[model samples]
Target: MRFEIQFSGHENIRSNHQKTIEITKESHLTPQGDCIVGVNASASCADLPRELKDKLKNSDSKITFSISVENYEFIIKGNGHQDLILTHEEDIVIRKSDFICPRTLAVKCDKASDLLPREMVELLRNPNTKGVFSITID
Candidate 1:
């Protein structure tokens, strides 16, 4: 199954955090939010589809998410867990660690914001740039 989130880029998108990748519902960005790749997000953790959230709570579920913008694409793979609450209201986060939080979408992710290509990070710095974060579960 699949779910997609639409979001826009921001000039302050640093994409330099070593452990996490994030998108937020806030329209504004600050350089200190180094993990946030997009803002004005279409969905927060609590806003995810019920079916998708259910699957994401299963320990056996495998999740893949593609962060696509313009001509660039970054893929992240992670496993779901029974511990996931998936109910944060303002943000969606992908973590390279096994941390579980309401804002986390996938844990043990293969990539964090710092791993994103510099070219892609540059594009993500444009406030007008649009992105699609699509997730598939199996």
Candidate 2:
């Protein structure tokens, strides 16, 4: 079976590099048996919860993730830095001490379907609508 996600929000957040951040895409199946999507956490540091910050700072930390969007949420039981891939087509080596600012997080999917709704795919392809997508898991 396949999972579908819808991302949408107009809130502007800045990254550590001072770039405007936004949610770019809804989650979708990848060739590597994973579901990947982008999130712009530019303003994350300013309001990041202390507990979450501590978890991210720890090298041995494994934090659980529950991303809620629309009427559904995906529960991921691990550190995003360790569990997700940074890119869709390439495997890059990331240092354990490396930090993830505002970026995409890839969630592994077992037997995830490659198909996606045509409309959703079109939205993803549109550059103008890049940062307001939200999610709904199926």
Candidate 3:
């Protein structure tokens, strides 16, 4: 079976410095579906809930990740740093819909505020919609 891999956060998607990786595709044939791929801390830090870990752990391996995929955008706000918008050109960014709290900076997935872990819910809310784009990693 094949799977789609996506990472979203800073910008340099293809780089090794990514913070979070999400696998948007799921296998109905498998026990879990529609999950991200990576370690527990990574997923949790990425804002994926503990409840969803099983599915994410079982995801397919052929990842098609993007560093800040075109469909989504995000902002970074943390202590001692100016709030900024992360882009695809930076190695730290992941794919669309993923989150990353840089060591010195916190992040807000402009499009995915509602789905954030409850503790992070207060940091950011609601992403203003931008132009639409489409990508199918499967």
Evaluated with lDDT, which candidate comes out highest? 1
* Candidate 1 local lDDT, 23-134, one digit each (tens): 9999988789999999999999999989999999998999999999999999999889899989999999989999988898889888899999999999998988999999
Our model 2 lands, by Cα RMSD against the true structure, at: 11.9
Collision count for each candidate, in order: 0, 13, 14
Q: Tell me, by TM-score, which candidate is best.
A: 1
TM-scores, in order shown? 0.97, 0.32, 0.19
lDDT of each: 0.92, 0.30, 0.24
Candidate 3, residues 3-118, lDDT tens digits: the string is 22243221111212123323221111121311222111112223433332223233231222222233333332211113322221212223333333332112222222223342
User: Residue 84 deviation, candidate 1, in Å?
Assistant: 0.5
TM-score of 1: 0.97
Shift in Å, residue 121, candidate 1: 0.8
**1 or 2, greater by TM-score:** 1
lDDT tens readout by residue for model 2, 23-73:
333333233322233333122222334444444444454444343433433
User: Between the candidate structures 2 and 3, which one is better when assessed by TM-score?
Assistant: 2
